[model samples]
Target: MNKSLLKLTFTFVALLFGLNTFAQDDFQGKAYYMSKTTMDMDQWGGREMSPDQKKRIEERMKSFLEKEYILTFNKSESIYKEDEKLEAPGSGRGWGGFASSFTGGPKYKNVKDQELLQDQEFFGKQFLIKDALKPLEWKMGTETKQIGQYTCFKATATKVVDEFDWRSMRRRQPPPKKKDSSETGDSAKADSDDPMNEIEVPKTIEVVAWYTPQIPINQGPDDYWGLPGLILEVNADRTTILCTKIVMNPEEKEDIDKPKKGDEVTQAEYNDIVTKKMTEMREMYSGRGRRN
Candidate 1:
């Protein structure tokens, strides 16, 4: 075996031995992550927009694109949530308002139990999404790097994109030109009436993660986990989430509780509910446009 692979193997063995001696109840960690997503302005008609107009749009969507999160974990369970901050008046008004409905609340993951629960508030209604933890068949590599004070190993996986995950969504490319021009005007008018026609989500995305065996806990921000150690960074599609700070066994630790204040539904059912609501919204807007 290569030197890097040998070293990683030895570390894994040591981690396995160490876990048995560790105090699971008293041991806890809090990881602070900064999440940022890149948006392609050109895909969203940026070429025709002036610099000021584009800046305004970006400012309005800033909260949705950039965020901070905290992951609190023990050996088997963890709660990942956004570090909420008060926004200025009129902030997050247009596109941000639309995205907020899909953004979930505190997410609880129990690795030992293979359980996942998330709290979501959609259009003034609460939903608790209950489901099994989505497993990733990660291909581990012998590559090594340093993140903060820990030695990190590289791992990769292909994730099936969730239909409602807006991070992987993009504007659909315009349709090809047709030889028959008779239906052109009607097609354009119909497409303009429904906003959902412009959006598209990819089927899959490549996920790259860096994990440190030093922590020896299978926990990560958002929906990522199952590594041999704590995942310190995740680069998936247009979004990147990196660990900025880690607090191990702080004096005051928050309880890792599963949210129970919403209508219980599975992930698939929640997606269907959102899809139906969005379709209804599209029809309402289309009817209003016709009347005008």
Candidate 2:
């Protein structure tokens, strides 16, 4: 090659590298998401309740069912958290307390490093769940839709539901009636009295996600990620998380750092811990009921 041509090629490559670095350093975005989950009232004994009772139950559950979250992202890192707001008086009673105990706090993801760090406060104990990012095998489709000013493409995946994920939990169906008396032993009666035996979670759930190439960041709310673009909407089983607003390169940027203030544990280990604690509570409640 001629000397001039070689020099020009080198210059072009250097310019490209510099521009990529600059873009990574200066690019930041904040995505606001509104999440809502629908529950089958009949499955939760709502059918037995009066109309007024059902309405009150729904009102209390609204705090958990409908929520807003913020996802702040830069090139390879992102932090997702619920948007904090004051609860109405008496909204945090009964089931709210149980839900809050199992709910996780801010979650931080490092896409480049393939790391996930989440803060979870189960009951009164705090745990830092440090684990590899769970990759979803997404089947991308040619379908397209417009979300605000951005065009989004469709993708779907089947996710194995976590054992302790309450979002997929449902009341266990009763066993079929047995004509013989042998099936209704004392052991079976004891099991029926334990409330914990009534709850069950699905093994897997189908997730449909909508991602936009305009953002060009592989990030999403909750545990959803690994797309070619930023995910704008997610339909996972009973829950829907939709992006409501986007702020690009905002002047005030929040730090995307891993949570450090908790006993470190892997995702599986944390699940086990929660499971053990729940079992203990269940046993205690059963003992008290037997005593009465």
Candidate 3:
């Protein structure tokens, strides 16, 4: 063979082998997430609920207070779903009513397309939430930390959300208390510790996330993303979702397909729907209290 022709042939063979090897090196990923929720029980406490009642409420909701999830992803696509939960049915009581109010369903994100798909259930009806990814501005920090074996960088961003958001069944503001002429002085005024006064609708939330460049993916649990790497820990709105473990290129690559069930709606539209529904329920319960 001619010397130049032989060199070209060898180069072509090496290129083909490199491409094959890259194709076989799976980037399929799996990440485990655990979320903890803490609510301001001030409204339910005070004169409305006694110490015994507060204890009951907390004990009953021990299971719903925390959640676990698993995120399956690749380089450009990902799906986040809840892990197996052992929660029993909630009763028709104080925060317990919130149990049936919000359940974080499967969320699918296509980083390549900048789209989002989330499955939600409210009062037994399914809703498929489809919307564009919320644009985030993360300030990268010079700090680095180790989460497991991966070195992670710090990122922070501000997230503004509806004050009455029930997505997480969080502390939604209720109807303002009416001033009574008979009650005078500071005793009548709402206390500063009252969360209802401090935390109102249209609240600003700060997001702190730690992501690992080793993962090289803009993916995280729930609605969090737009980071330089896969987020291993996220804290926002007093809730935290931390990565318990990660398995890259898992043998069983679970489906990353988008959920195709339920009534379709956008993020804003769904928020409005939940606000209206929660208001109605609140009114119904208040009327019952008045009658009692």
lDDT top scorer: 1
Residue 134, model 3: lDDT of 87
Give one digit per residue, the lDDT tens place, for model 1 in 1-292.
Answer: 9897797687777587658745566788899999999999989899999999999888888988999999999999999999988889767756666776777889999999999999999998999999999999999998888999988889999999999898988999878888875666655676677888999999999999999888888889999999989999999999999999999888998888888999999999999999899888988888787778
Each model's number of backbone clashes? 0, 0, 2
The superposed Cα distance between candidate 1 and the true structure at residue 15, in angstroms, equals 1.9
State TM-scores per candidate: 0.93, 0.90, 0.74
Looking at candidate 2, what is the lDDT of residue 98?
77
Write down the lDDT that model 1 would get. 0.90
lDDT of 2 by residue, 123-184 (tens): 78888999999999999876777899877879999999998888888999988877875756
For model 3, the local distance difference test gives 0.73
Question: For model 2, what is the alpha-carbon lDDT of residue 267?
Answer: 94
* Decoy 3 TM-score against native: 0.74
Indicate the worst ten consecutive residues by lDDT in candidate 3: 187-196
Model 1 clash pairs are none
User: Model 3 clash pairs?
Assistant: 163-201, 163-202
Model 3, which residues run further than 4 Å from truth?
A: 1-26, 40-43, 46-56, 87-97, 164-202, 282-292
